[model samples]
Target: MNGYRKLPTAVNYQFAEDLYSVFKTFGLDLDRLSYSSQTGQMKKLIEELETPDNLQKISQLSLDADFADMKTKHEAFETIFADQAGANADLRQMTSATAIRKILEKNLKTYFNLLTVMKEVAGWELLYSDTNELVKAAKNSEIKRKDENPS
Candidate 1:
Protein backbone atom coordinates (compact mmCIF):
# COMPACT_ATOMS: atom_id res chain seq x y z
CA MET A 1 0.00 0.00 0.00
CA ASN A 2 2.96 2.30 -0.55
CA GLY A 3 2.17 4.00 -3.85
CA TYR A 4 -1.45 2.95 -3.66
CA ARG A 5 -1.81 4.91 -0.44
CA LYS A 6 -0.72 8.04 -2.28
CA LEU A 7 -3.24 7.64 -5.06
CA PRO A 8 -5.62 10.53 -4.66
CA THR A 9 -9.30 10.68 -5.53
CA ALA A 10 -8.99 14.46 -5.66
CA VAL A 11 -10.39 16.14 -8.72
CA ASN A 12 -11.44 19.77 -9.07
CA TYR A 13 -15.00 19.95 -7.86
CA GLN A 14 -15.91 22.55 -10.45
CA PHE A 15 -14.45 20.42 -13.21
CA ALA A 16 -16.27 17.33 -12.01
CA GLU A 17 -19.49 19.28 -11.76
CA ASP A 18 -19.06 20.58 -15.27
CA LEU A 19 -18.29 17.10 -16.50
CA TYR A 20 -21.37 15.76 -14.76
CA SER A 21 -23.44 18.46 -16.43
CA VAL A 22 -22.10 17.43 -19.79
CA PHE A 23 -22.80 13.82 -19.03
CA LYS A 24 -26.36 14.73 -18.14
CA THR A 25 -26.75 16.77 -21.29
CA PHE A 26 -25.65 13.93 -23.55
CA GLY A 27 -26.98 11.13 -21.39
CA LEU A 28 -23.51 9.67 -21.16
CA ASP A 29 -21.48 8.67 -18.15
CA LEU A 30 -19.20 11.59 -17.40
CA ASP A 31 -17.28 12.75 -20.49
CA ARG A 32 -16.73 9.36 -22.01
CA LEU A 33 -15.93 10.96 -25.30
CA SER A 34 -12.59 12.32 -26.43
CA TYR A 35 -13.58 15.65 -24.91
CA SER A 36 -12.26 14.85 -21.43
CA SER A 37 -9.51 13.05 -19.57
CA GLN A 38 -11.97 11.51 -17.13
CA THR A 39 -12.29 8.32 -19.15
CA GLY A 40 -8.54 7.79 -18.89
CA GLN A 41 -8.67 8.58 -15.21
CA MET A 42 -11.25 5.85 -14.70
CA LYS A 43 -9.22 3.36 -16.64
CA LYS A 44 -6.19 4.22 -14.54
CA LEU A 45 -8.16 3.63 -11.39
CA ILE A 46 -9.23 0.18 -12.55
CA GLU A 47 -5.70 -0.60 -13.58
CA GLU A 48 -4.36 0.46 -10.26
CA LEU A 49 -7.04 -1.50 -8.50
CA GLU A 50 -6.12 -4.69 -10.33
CA THR A 51 -2.40 -4.42 -9.89
CA PRO A 52 -0.59 -7.72 -9.39
CA ASP A 53 -0.15 -7.09 -5.72
CA ASN A 54 -3.76 -6.05 -5.25
CA LEU A 55 -4.95 -9.02 -7.24
CA GLN A 56 -2.87 -11.30 -5.09
CA LYS A 57 -4.44 -9.90 -1.98
CA ILE A 58 -7.90 -10.23 -3.47
CA SER A 59 -7.21 -13.83 -4.48
CA GLN A 60 -6.41 -14.69 -0.92
CA LEU A 61 -10.04 -14.07 -0.06
CA SER A 62 -11.47 -15.89 -3.10
CA LEU A 63 -13.31 -12.80 -4.18
CA ASP A 64 -12.43 -13.08 -7.85
CA ALA A 65 -16.04 -13.24 -8.99
CA ASP A 66 -16.86 -9.95 -7.30
CA PHE A 67 -13.80 -8.32 -8.80
CA ALA A 68 -14.60 -9.73 -12.21
CA ASP A 69 -18.11 -8.37 -12.09
CA MET A 70 -16.82 -4.93 -11.27
CA LYS A 71 -14.35 -5.06 -14.12
CA THR A 72 -17.05 -6.23 -16.51
CA LYS A 73 -19.21 -3.27 -15.63
CA HIS A 74 -16.36 -0.87 -16.19
CA GLU A 75 -15.58 -2.52 -19.48
CA ALA A 76 -19.17 -2.22 -20.57
CA PHE A 77 -19.13 1.44 -19.68
CA GLU A 78 -15.99 1.90 -21.68
CA THR A 79 -17.48 0.14 -24.68
CA ILE A 80 -20.61 2.25 -24.67
CA PHE A 81 -18.52 5.35 -24.17
CA ALA A 82 -16.29 4.54 -27.12
CA ASP A 83 -19.27 3.88 -29.33
CA GLN A 84 -20.99 7.11 -28.36
CA ALA A 85 -17.78 9.06 -28.84
CA GLY A 86 -17.59 8.05 -32.49
CA ALA A 87 -21.25 8.03 -33.43
CA ASN A 88 -23.05 10.91 -35.10
CA ALA A 89 -25.46 13.03 -33.11
CA ASP A 90 -28.51 11.06 -34.12
CA LEU A 91 -26.81 7.77 -33.36
CA ARG A 92 -25.64 9.14 -30.04
CA GLN A 93 -29.20 10.07 -29.18
CA MET A 94 -30.00 6.37 -29.10
CA THR A 95 -27.76 5.93 -26.08
CA SER A 96 -28.87 6.60 -22.55
CA ALA A 97 -26.97 7.09 -19.33
CA THR A 98 -29.33 4.84 -17.42
CA ALA A 99 -27.52 1.67 -18.28
CA ILE A 100 -24.17 3.31 -17.80
CA ARG A 101 -25.10 4.64 -14.41
CA LYS A 102 -26.63 1.34 -13.39
CA ILE A 103 -23.53 -0.62 -14.19
CA LEU A 104 -21.25 1.93 -12.60
CA GLU A 105 -23.37 2.15 -9.50
CA LYS A 106 -23.46 -1.62 -9.21
CA ASN A 107 -19.75 -1.77 -9.73
CA LEU A 108 -19.24 0.78 -6.97
CA LYS A 109 -21.45 -1.18 -4.63
CA THR A 110 -19.50 -4.32 -5.40
CA TYR A 111 -16.21 -2.62 -4.65
CA PHE A 112 -17.55 -1.11 -1.46
CA ASN A 113 -18.81 -4.50 -0.36
CA LEU A 114 -15.44 -5.99 -1.13
CA LEU A 115 -13.71 -3.41 0.97
CA THR A 116 -16.14 -3.94 3.80
CA VAL A 117 -15.55 -7.68 3.77
CA MET A 118 -11.84 -7.24 3.26
CA LYS A 119 -11.58 -5.39 6.54
CA GLU A 120 -12.04 -8.70 8.30
CA VAL A 121 -9.23 -10.29 6.34
CA ALA A 122 -5.71 -10.23 7.76
CA GLY A 123 -3.30 -7.61 6.28
CA TRP A 124 -6.20 -5.52 4.96
CA GLU A 125 -6.92 -3.27 7.90
CA LEU A 126 -4.84 -0.29 6.87
CA LEU A 127 -6.06 -0.39 3.28
CA TYR A 128 -9.65 -0.66 4.38
CA SER A 129 -9.27 2.15 6.91
CA ASP A 130 -7.61 4.43 4.41
CA THR A 131 -10.22 3.69 1.76
CA ASN A 132 -13.00 4.33 4.27
CA GLU A 133 -11.44 7.65 5.23
CA LEU A 134 -11.29 8.68 1.59
CA VAL A 135 -14.97 7.85 1.16
CA LYS A 136 -15.87 9.83 4.30
CA ALA A 137 -13.87 12.80 3.08
CA ALA A 138 -15.64 12.73 -0.27
CA LYS A 139 -19.03 12.50 1.41
CA ASN A 140 -18.18 15.38 3.71
CA SER A 141 -17.03 17.50 0.78
CA GLU A 142 -20.29 16.85 -1.03
CA ILE A 143 -22.29 17.81 2.06
CA LYS A 144 -20.30 21.00 2.50
CA ARG A 145 -20.69 21.94 -1.12
CA LYS A 146 -24.42 21.30 -1.04
CA ASP A 147 -24.78 23.39 2.12
CA GLU A 148 -22.90 26.31 0.65
CA ASN A 149 -24.91 26.20 -2.56
CA PRO A 150 -28.33 24.95 -1.65
CA SER A 151 -30.28 23.72 -4.62
Candidate 2:
Protein backbone atom coordinates (compact mmCIF):
# COMPACT_ATOMS: atom_id res chain seq x y z
CA MET A 1 0.00 0.00 0.00
CA ASN A 2 1.01 3.65 -0.41
CA GLY A 3 1.25 3.74 3.38
CA TYR A 4 4.59 1.95 3.18
CA ARG A 5 6.64 4.60 1.49
CA LYS A 6 10.33 3.97 0.68
CA LEU A 7 12.25 6.49 2.73
CA PRO A 8 15.92 7.54 2.48
CA THR A 9 18.49 6.76 5.22
CA ALA A 10 18.26 10.06 7.10
CA VAL A 11 14.47 10.25 6.79
CA ASN A 12 14.10 6.67 7.92
CA TYR A 13 16.05 7.28 11.16
CA GLN A 14 14.02 10.39 11.94
CA PHE A 15 10.84 8.52 11.18
CA ALA A 16 11.89 5.74 13.54
CA GLU A 17 12.25 8.15 16.43
CA ASP A 18 8.90 9.76 15.63
CA LEU A 19 7.33 6.32 15.34
CA TYR A 20 8.55 5.44 18.84
CA SER A 21 6.82 8.55 20.13
CA VAL A 22 3.59 7.60 18.39
CA PHE A 23 3.67 4.09 19.86
CA LYS A 24 4.12 5.60 23.32
CA THR A 25 0.97 7.68 22.82
CA PHE A 26 -0.99 4.51 21.95
CA GLY A 27 0.34 2.60 25.04
CA LEU A 28 2.70 0.28 23.08
CA ASP A 29 6.07 0.43 24.76
CA LEU A 30 8.24 -1.28 22.14
CA ASP A 31 11.44 -0.27 23.92
CA ARG A 32 10.50 -2.68 26.68
CA LEU A 33 10.69 -5.70 24.31
CA SER A 34 13.65 -8.02 24.62
CA TYR A 35 16.12 -8.10 21.74
CA SER A 36 17.89 -11.27 22.97
CA SER A 37 17.80 -14.18 20.53
CA GLN A 38 15.97 -16.50 22.97
CA THR A 39 13.12 -13.98 23.40
CA GLY A 40 12.02 -14.43 19.77
CA GLN A 41 10.61 -17.92 20.33
CA MET A 42 8.82 -16.88 23.50
CA LYS A 43 7.33 -13.79 21.80
CA LYS A 44 5.81 -15.85 18.98
CA LEU A 45 3.68 -17.85 21.42
CA ILE A 46 2.27 -14.69 23.07
CA GLU A 47 1.09 -13.17 19.77
CA GLU A 48 -2.56 -12.77 18.80
CA LEU A 49 -4.11 -15.62 16.77
CA GLU A 50 -6.32 -13.86 14.20
CA THR A 51 -5.99 -11.26 11.49
CA PRO A 52 -8.56 -8.46 11.35
CA ASP A 53 -10.57 -10.12 8.57
CA ASN A 54 -11.10 -13.34 10.52
CA LEU A 55 -12.31 -11.54 13.65
CA GLN A 56 -15.75 -11.06 12.14
CA LYS A 57 -16.15 -14.84 12.10
CA ILE A 58 -15.42 -15.00 15.84
CA SER A 59 -17.94 -12.23 16.56
CA GLN A 60 -20.68 -14.01 14.56
CA LEU A 61 -20.68 -16.88 17.06
CA SER A 62 -22.16 -15.86 20.40
CA LEU A 63 -24.05 -16.83 23.57
CA ASP A 64 -27.14 -17.65 21.46
CA ALA A 65 -26.00 -21.29 21.46
CA ASP A 66 -24.98 -22.84 24.78
CA PHE A 67 -23.58 -25.95 23.04
CA ALA A 68 -20.73 -27.96 24.54
CA ASP A 69 -18.38 -26.64 21.83
CA MET A 70 -19.41 -23.07 22.53
CA LYS A 71 -19.38 -23.31 26.32
CA THR A 72 -15.88 -21.95 26.89
CA LYS A 73 -16.30 -19.09 24.44
CA HIS A 74 -19.69 -18.21 25.96
CA GLU A 75 -18.22 -18.15 29.43
CA ALA A 76 -15.34 -15.93 28.33
CA PHE A 77 -17.73 -13.47 26.72
CA GLU A 78 -19.90 -13.49 29.84
CA THR A 79 -16.89 -12.66 31.98
CA ILE A 80 -15.84 -9.80 29.69
CA PHE A 81 -19.31 -8.24 29.61
CA ALA A 82 -19.58 -8.60 33.35
CA ASP A 83 -16.27 -6.79 33.72
CA GLN A 84 -17.61 -4.07 31.43
CA ALA A 85 -20.65 -3.71 33.65
CA GLY A 86 -18.42 -3.44 36.70
CA ALA A 87 -16.42 -0.69 35.02
CA ASN A 88 -19.27 1.77 35.44
CA ALA A 89 -21.06 2.35 38.76
CA ASP A 90 -24.49 2.89 37.18
CA LEU A 91 -24.12 -0.31 35.16
CA ARG A 92 -23.10 -2.23 38.30
CA GLN A 93 -26.42 -1.47 39.98
CA MET A 94 -28.68 -2.20 37.00
CA THR A 95 -30.60 -5.51 36.88
CA SER A 96 -33.41 -4.39 34.59
CA ALA A 97 -33.68 -6.35 31.31
CA THR A 98 -33.49 -3.21 29.17
CA ALA A 99 -30.42 -1.90 31.00
CA ILE A 100 -28.67 -5.27 30.79
CA ARG A 101 -29.23 -5.43 27.05
CA LYS A 102 -27.86 -1.94 26.57
CA ILE A 103 -24.76 -2.81 28.61
CA LEU A 104 -24.20 -5.97 26.54
CA GLU A 105 -24.60 -3.97 23.35
CA LYS A 106 -22.07 -1.45 24.59
CA ASN A 107 -19.70 -4.28 25.55
CA LEU A 108 -19.92 -5.82 22.07
CA LYS A 109 -19.26 -2.48 20.41
CA THR A 110 -16.24 -1.80 22.63
CA TYR A 111 -14.87 -5.30 22.03
CA PHE A 112 -15.26 -4.90 18.27
CA ASN A 113 -13.56 -1.52 18.37
CA LEU A 114 -10.59 -3.09 20.16
CA LEU A 115 -10.45 -5.87 17.55
CA THR A 116 -10.41 -3.29 14.75
CA VAL A 117 -7.45 -1.50 16.34
CA MET A 118 -5.54 -4.75 16.73
CA LYS A 119 -6.29 -5.67 13.13
CA GLU A 120 -5.13 -2.32 11.82
CA VAL A 121 -1.83 -2.71 13.68
CA ALA A 122 -1.23 -6.31 12.59
CA GLY A 123 -1.87 -6.07 8.82
CA TRP A 124 1.34 -4.28 7.76
CA GLU A 125 4.75 -5.73 6.88
CA LEU A 126 8.32 -4.40 7.25
CA LEU A 127 10.40 -4.57 4.11
CA TYR A 128 14.18 -4.88 4.34
CA SER A 129 16.69 -2.22 3.18
CA ASP A 130 20.49 -2.02 2.69
CA THR A 131 21.12 -0.01 5.88
CA ASN A 132 20.46 -1.79 9.19
CA GLU A 133 19.46 1.56 10.63
CA LEU A 134 16.96 2.04 7.81
CA VAL A 135 15.45 -1.42 8.26
CA LYS A 136 15.35 -0.95 12.03
CA ALA A 137 13.66 2.40 11.52
CA ALA A 138 11.11 0.81 9.18
CA LYS A 139 10.18 -1.78 11.77
CA ASN A 140 9.89 0.83 14.53
CA SER A 141 7.74 3.00 12.28
CA GLU A 142 5.35 0.08 11.77
CA ILE A 143 4.56 -0.28 15.52
CA LYS A 144 2.94 3.17 15.44
CA ARG A 145 1.81 3.58 11.87
CA LYS A 146 -0.46 0.78 10.80
CA ASP A 147 -1.90 3.81 9.04
CA GLU A 148 -0.90 7.49 8.98
CA ASN A 149 -3.68 8.30 11.43
CA PRO A 150 -4.28 5.60 14.07
CA SER A 151 -7.17 7.59 15.53
What do the candidate models score in CA lDDT, each in turn?
Answer: 0.66, 0.44
Q: Give one digit per residue, the lDDT tens place, for model 2 in 1-151.
A: 0122234344344434443333344335433654332233323322221334222323333212323333455356557655765677685576989888999989966865665455546442221112335646877899768777778
Question: Model 1, 37-140: lDDT tens per residue?
Answer: 66675566557557786565556545578779967987887788777767766666675788789989999889989989999999998989998999999999
Best by lDDT: 1
Model 1 lDDT, full chain set: 0.66
In model 1, what is the error at residue 121, expressed in angstroms?
A: 1.1
lDDT of 1 at 102: 91
Residue 136 deviation, candidate 2, in Å?
A: 39
